[model samples]
Target: MHRSGSTTHSLFLSPQHPHSERTKRRPGLSAFLCFLAVLAVSLSPVPGAAADHRRPAPPPAVTAEGLRVLPAVAPVMSCGDVTGVDLRRAAGAEVTITSAVVVSENTPNPYCEVRGTIAPANTIVVQLPLEGWTQRYLQTGCGGLCGNASINYGQAAECPVVEDGTVASATTDMGHQGQNDGSWAAGNPQAQIDFAYRGVHVTALTAKALITKFYGRSPAYSYFTGCSDGGREALMEAQRFPDDFDGIAAGAPANNMAVQNTYHHAWNVLANKDADGNDILLAGKLPLIHDAVLTACDTLDGLADGVLDDPRACGFDPASLICAAGQDPAACLSAAEADVVRKLHDGAVDDKGRRLEPEISHEWGSELAWTLFVPVAQGDPVSSEQFALSYLRYLADPNNPRPDFELTDLEFTKEAFWETMQSSSYMSAMDPDLGAFKRSGGKLLLWHGWNDHHISPQSTLAYYDAVRGTMGKHAVNDFARLFMFPGVEHCSGGEGPDSFDVLTPVMAWVESGRAPASIIASKIETADDGAETVSRTRPVYPYPAVARYDGSGSTDDAANFASYTPKREIGPDYKWLGSRLYSSDYQTWCRAEGTELVCGQHRGGRNWLSREAGR
Candidate 1:
């Protein structure tokens, strides 16, 4: 997977390069000096003091018509004393406390870090603030195979509770400690069950138990946030465990796992190969395709901002990029290369042209990130090849593992497509019925990058449309919203403002009953001296509405933009072989029984072989 190292900065426009009249006013020298003096006093460490127990002031309230603020609670137990508390029987699963100590190094505030493992093998780490605890619990999702215990708060950079370290946070390694490859699931039914949905549920329960024990009260609000595979985990929570979190932010989710790995990713690589087994399209021609796409579609939204606001409306054909006779081969693609490019963008298709996955394979502006599937050198394996091969060998068919499966063995026909989706209910999270979550007052904020290289942005759109179809549009609108970042890639980083705070809007929506109208996303550039400054700002609106530039102000300023409905409407349900999986009837509940895992309808007498063969 690709990643960006850009530091998340303040959302406000920079004073050095003011964009409009709405830019924040710069502070005078006297006021700045006074603020620095106050900050120095507050941060100054006490001599011979073991710990600093002072709490920082909470941020301003979000005022609205029906605003309800979640209260903050102080810790009742000392940081060091937390290590002595026993919870072997308190948590639903058997628990072990490996270590508990107060940590203040390289953090905004002091907190007690608790590291432990749950029953079987679910490693978890929880952080409880020693002071200024806002009765809120946040659990982050993991990416890839999620075999390492870690916590990331990048998605919540704008939330004051996370920025000030006033919120309790925790994360888990799913189950089994191994490399990101699917080998962790081979011959292990319990670990597969844990990774599918049980791991997150158990971890949430255990973390809340610890928070209550340390604070003498349960948290008032809880939230979950993640992107990529983490995004899949976020949706799994909403579908499987509706009562777990009050709010969820899922970004570029990989929810349709079975088809994504078996066909979508495999097709990305196989489609680019010629009959001679030579690579048809190389990495060098990506820029040529991307530039052509921008020239054709960048201004579709009434602004020339190097991004396509709605790529589905862009009808750029790859045949136009085909090289003419005696033209420079270095600058243009050959006919064969152009066809390969067309196949990649068209997504996985059967002999009759039916889609294997939903919608387009990859968006137009995302050609640059196609390096994930396109190889720079002949005979070199791409990232998608490895991802697909791994899943096929281990996680695809849990009951009948194919440890020696190769990428060449995959088939893309209608029959083969149904074969791949036989066990989809086990790992995929494409369930569209979120009625339980909506009834529980849980708000879902779904976002995806239009230029994501790994997962197609259209997949997210397909799922969102399915949700709206399952639940009435008006009912879904009150509890769910989708924001599509124009030029952003998988999770973050691309040609647009990729850094934004989704947590703040979700928190406001969950606690104050105020739905988000728009979110400000920023692109921060870091200088050589470690100083950070905002270079660009844009306001992204909910789906079906896009940011339109006011003709008078700078296009770089968010204040110069307003949400406008698009002229074209998104299509109905995607024409895919696995589209039936979107229905609730395809959902399955699995549990480990001795050495075998049983699913619904065939649990009593039928075995995995008979069920799969009959399908």
Candidate 2:
């Protein structure tokens, strides 16, 4: 996947050089931790500390009444024309401006689309509305491994919001030009750094500087939005640069980055393979497993609308699908197939009950997609295998730099898992502290589909809990909110209502001090050829509050539903794996004992580090 779409334009008017904005070499663990400590203090507007001078004034309104007073443009520009503008920056001569043209709006509003590259590798685009400037800036996120900047749907809803309000929006490829290819980061250190955190951050800063030059004033407010890896970027902005965004909306954040792509993904792929190396859990059997899961749990939330509103509470046993003596393998799952589903629902865990990663909800909404990585037909490695192999071959193993590394060379034991974590410290963003973000008056809206298979909703839940545990519940609620979408898969689309406007509520909260209690989600009923018709709407309440039926009337209408606070389940405690990247308040005996067989200690309990685990 090489850089595609429109070709780049010449450097127009770049005021600052890339050299001026150049980042230092990636920090070591000790240096990064120390930098975080200083950053927290610097971002916090606590008493006695210097006041934040960068905090901008309230943005001007772009209301119809206000638009009446604005001046109209004399000449409308074309979509691929940039006649007069300078954009040369010091990063290097390699950076090129691909295009700068006016995009005709559906609402008939016009905006300039400025596209460019950043030196060695980085595709960036900024869209500046020609009128109705709201003094707000938005940077959307890229999905998967962020190989392409054009794959950003993070701002799907945001584009309209920004256009309507005349807000400027920008997006970047996150340092590569392909999509879902781990090979892009194979030997590229700068690309890896950009993927890890730099790309989005640089884009945000560069976009803002360009916006200021275009509009003669900086944006009053800034935001970052993304899901999946984009979600990771959103968190990275909030965590690494607390002042970057006034509001951030992250969905299904792959914050446990390296772990998910490596160990967790490997665990899922390995689960599908049998003793003879045959994949019994083929795509054909998905319906069987899905029906079994739905039968046991679809009605758990007071409605049986082909979606599980609360899969976590539904105790569906996969062993029930195990065939009796007379049943055929095609009709009923063999013991091995049932075991695979069980492991997926149970999540990745060591010999002990300790969860390596959160359980991927293997319900009706997400089961079909599970077959994507199962090499049932050709015995070839799937995307997960490709990703894992690349990570192990290039990034994870310091000595083994061979690109030809096979999936079989990788081990799945606890020791092997710990070893992988050791080399991936710079990649993962599992840090739980959000005090800096909160104190900086940054508002965070986190959401994840309950039926997400790519990244577990439980992982997001765990992260939210960590923030709450580290910062008190009330304190977290003051600045951050979590909305769990039941039955939605990955970022969107599933058995449940997946379409919703999280951005509107988050922006309202950020600007007006009003918090969002619930966001309405809708599922459209499509015709035979997939043309959308009427939609079934429902309100997605914040975490702990689920949409329960009102007992009568149309179940499809959101009016018949109400938010109900369910009894809270005691979720996973924040247990730290002995990754040099992961921070720990307690010690793991496996790090001390060097084996899981004899490891024993107070699980999830906080304590001082032992000499061995401390290493």
Candidate 3:
């Protein structure tokens, strides 16, 4: 996907509504029909049917489910049909589709476009160019595993895997199905292990193969981009298959899967009460809180701008919104209810002294409760939530499942930091070793939002610091760049500014080798219906130091945020959580410094985010 020229714009909208549409089942092909069709019987053999076929004379009956794959030249097995699509004008480049290629014999999953050309010399190709077109991979919003649950455009749970013949793209179902990634590899630990290991290995092989088939040669450069769980995936690739992509863009990755789920369960528990013991506020309150928050914090950027330029600097308090006596029974949170927000925003701890992690934002709970998260107070019976709890359960145990999201202060203890979560524990600190990726002469563009309620932007800084800490700071700085957005939530919706394609500079850094010192992040404008409306831009600092806006020129200009130097020197200050990444015992020494300052280990370590958006 190429960016439009300056003053031009493009918007990609996914049309499929999250799972609300009822699916009609089609009667599958008949088993008897296969016996009469000679070609179908020969090529569509079921798995493990080799011995039977090798017999002096194969059995007369053949089944699609019993087919074994052999090399294309092995026999005259029936070749699938293919279709060609005209994409030259579609991509605005000399793009071509040889034909739709169906990789499977039992199921006719046809996909067209053997290659895509962003420019005359650029082509993202694929192997197995077909003779016809059909759907290559099913799409879903469920991250990791595609759960039966559905979401919408405002809240994209996940993006289904599309084998649309790019240079290389992948979806694992995370080893299970029903998710945007189709991580069809859940429940089975072996699948998880493979997903963590061989999954990347196999995918790299497939991508290389596709690059060869489409461009007549393998790709000299490749990249990966994803947010939340996708962030986890990006890191997974770097750790397990670092050589595949030259650069990667991961946003708020859900690394420590196990504990994150536990934390979500716990947060949902905390969010349960209304002033009256009987009346409970539902998940719908999240957006309400989010809107209120943006209203209060958006102007902090000094432009009356509807974006939050610095969440850390904003002093708005949740207590300010508490319901006054008799202010419409259930409309607003009571003082007690507000306390929930405070402790939740602060983080959770159980009666046993164990602490449950908090959502990236206090407002994340209210929004996700109804907007995207699993609700316990609802008939569903899960407790505790903070956004990512559902994905964790869906990927780890799609067949059975966790007890929804049960919450207990006892479960939320000091020991519960992040290291203990069986599923999402490592998520908060999944910085991979990029020594090889950097040594290969590659460059990376990493960014996140500071106010991100989902995966905290702090996680991004932690990962970057790990790279800088391990490799020389200047060395990592040579090929890697980091951007932090101040108030963006999850990805897009926040009070601070939120418009601008962060990818352009990344592409520039990779292809042109013009290392980026910083990037300009923007938010929407009041009259943003026009194309060039993404006119606002803010300079983002590299690290340690921050971009402070100078009250001059248009606040919309990136030059307004004067660049400052990083304060944290390239030295040793970070610490691993323990044998586990989120271990309570392993101290950042920062957290030990206590939450007196804007940052420290106890405050949960390195704080970072994409330009104007929060990580």
Candidate 4:
């Protein structure tokens, strides 16, 4: 969320700048860990940490509501337009944010600038920064951080809220424009630069860097925080640029890019245009079902605060809401509608039972695909999905005109989705090898909401299991952790209490050497249920299990969400010839063609680590 006064805007399209953000020298584990330690202390405000905004600022580029904002400087300004507003020590570095504003980078075609903000702008500049760089720093709302998705909605900014409360703050918007459905990236290449990889990476890096710049050194520890696409960004840095941060918080990341789009595309086919071309889950219907969903799962956590601590264990079936012979038609689901949701929630299965890919869920109320990656809700489809299925007869080649968003409809067919689109485009978002990251003592935090209506939480679980299949569980536990939130939607905000600060356990593990076992999720009943409590504390299972209590609490509590650790269930159904990425056995044989480069030489799940794995 941004400060109270900043306005927001939006445009679409894509970028420029061919020089990659890659580092020539791979950092050693010790040097990497040491930098993190310095970074940690740099950020925490000690009793006498000096007047954080102690130094003079560059200059006040914009004045709104009497706040001095240092707009983009020379180098960055020259790279593109003065699109973002960064409020820092007009000069020195304290990492505290005073205020911020996002403007249009004016890129063209498909992308856009959303809004952004971080509090006490002065101290913010000092706290976040990677490799001593802070280009256009600011916070983002909804789609703000999700590769410029904020253009699709509205973000209510506010005063800064910190964890330590000393000089702590949070950010929204990466300081650009994209309030509506336009492609700002079409005009400027630099805007594309900041949007695609620079924005959050640099914001975080600069924040950490300035923290050190202000305190005469870095923090005793440092960490990265984000979810969904942000989670994808975090993992991208680790795999491609491993030395960026020591501790990272990745929740319900959108890994497996190909699969993500495919999932959503399929849903568009189902939810939007029914067999008769009628919409199934309409605008108002979402909230209706949302309320029903809550009614069924909220109390499972024991607390009636209208929050479900864990949805994985809630076990509320859409079928339960099916309209019976005498039930109220308004509240109950018709068999056809219930079937639509069941398909929406379940992984794809074809007429032959073959599993398709994964997409996010249908965001019950929001227009953005917040609920499911692909909200094919048995209704009229989004403009983009409409083009995919009918493209053969409706248009030119996939890349000919390049539809609307980053990836278009025709481009999402199974073949293009999993193969070409993923590897060739930024949208792939697949999990890269993190062996080197683990060796460097890097800590990763992965979280998934049992009811994550977006990219199915199962995808995260499957990804985690894939990691374990190759990384060795104990090693992963030593540095990586996964937490599952029940009833939460997308990144945060839903029927469940969606507020948490995981940087707590992340910092502990990085500097203090304390790895977290679990974090408590609270479900407060703010309604008349007063004083009622719904709480659950579940193990932060490293990978496979996204988080499930032992089925004890109200079944809604994290405590009740049992752990879903699937032992290598090698049965006739699932032959464990080897890790999917490595083995060439009959089971993996079907799934390993184009993705084979990521597997090991041994070619079987057992020897995934063989020389061939990293190929």
| Best by the TM-score measure | 1
User: What local lDDT does model 1 show for residue 355?
Assistant: 82
Query: Tens digit of lDDT per residue, candidate 2, span 58-146?
Result: 44333211111233222234445442444444232244667676666343356777887765577887777777766677788887766
Candidate 3 ranges with C-alpha deviation above 4 Å: 1-175, 179-187, 194-197, 274-303, 320-333, 352-355, 358-410, 413-432, 470-472, 524-532, 565-615
lDDT of 3 by residue, 527-558 (tens): 45433334455666656556666877787666
Model 2: residue 560 alpha-carbon error in angstroms:
1.9
Candidate 2: Cα lDDT at 182: 64
Q: Worst lDDT window (10 residues) for model 4? A: 152-161
The model with the greater lDDT, 1 or 3, is: 1
lDDT of 3 at 256: 53
Query: By lDDT, highest first, what's the ranking?
Result: 1, 2, 3, 4
Candidate 4 deviates by what RMSD?
14.5
Name the regions of candidate 1 deviating beyond 4 angstroms: 1-71, 88-91, 571-573, 601-615
The residue ranges of model 2 lying beyond 4 angstroms of the native Cα positions read 1-98, 105-107, 155-160, 163-165, 350-354, 359-365, 375-381, 398-400, 528-531, 570-615
Per-residue error for 308 in candidate 3, Å, reads 3.0
Candidate 2 lDDT: 0.63
TM-scores for all predictions: 0.87, 0.79, 0.59, 0.56
Cα lDDT over the full model 3: 0.42
Better of 1 and 4 by lDDT: 1
Regarding TM-score, does 2 or 4 come out ahead?
2
lDDT of each: 0.76, 0.63, 0.42, 0.41
Off by over 4 Å in 4: 1-161, 166-176, 179-182, 187-193, 202-212, 265-269, 282-335, 347-354, 359-413, 495-497, 525-615
Cα lDDT tens digits for candidate 4, 1-615: 111111111122111111111112112222322222232222221122234467744332322111123222222122122123343432222233333222222211111121223321111222222122222222321232232322111111111111111221223234345422223333333333343344454455544443343333434334456676567666655654455567677766765433444444455455444566566654445556667766776666445555444344445577777888987887777777777766665445444544454322332222223333234454333653533332222112222223342322334233432333323233223443578678766778778765565566766666666566667877677777777664566776555544444554565465445565555444434437443333432334444344444535464444455445555531122212112421122111011122121211112432332332233
Error of model 1, residue 97, in angstroms: 1.2
